[model samples]
Target: MHQLMHADLARAHLHERLADAERQRLAAYVVRVAKARRAARRAERAREQAQLRLRLLIN
Candidate 1:
């Protein structure tokens, strides 16, 4: 009976560890997506500025 209890406890611990790892992975993914979006926004702003400069020069 003691052995069975220990086995159950071990299984629960393993599941907890797996869940924690998944949470960490999801957090990292969210951070990466945010960074990518920021980068894209920055690039878009730069493109707009360049276009504006070109139009000013043409006029």
Candidate 2:
């Protein structure tokens, strides 16, 4: 999943560089979205692990 996000961002960056002048703006936006998605996923995993640890402590 992380790799997928990485690839998506890379592709978007590449396209931003290669795309026609008009489409480059959208490609840049796509790269930002992909980066945000990757950060969100990492945060979710960390939250889940913390919750699991709290559960273990309570039990």
Q: Which segments of candidate 2 are over 4 A away from where they belong?
A: 1-19
Which regions in candidate 1 have their CA more than 4 angstroms from the true location?
Answer: none
The pairs that clash in candidate 1 are none
Q: What TM-score does structure 2 among the candidates reach?
A: 0.61
User: Candidate 2 residues 1-59, lDDT tens each?
Assistant: 99999999999998887767668778899999999999999999999999999999999
Residue 10 displacement in candidate 1 (angstroms): 0.6
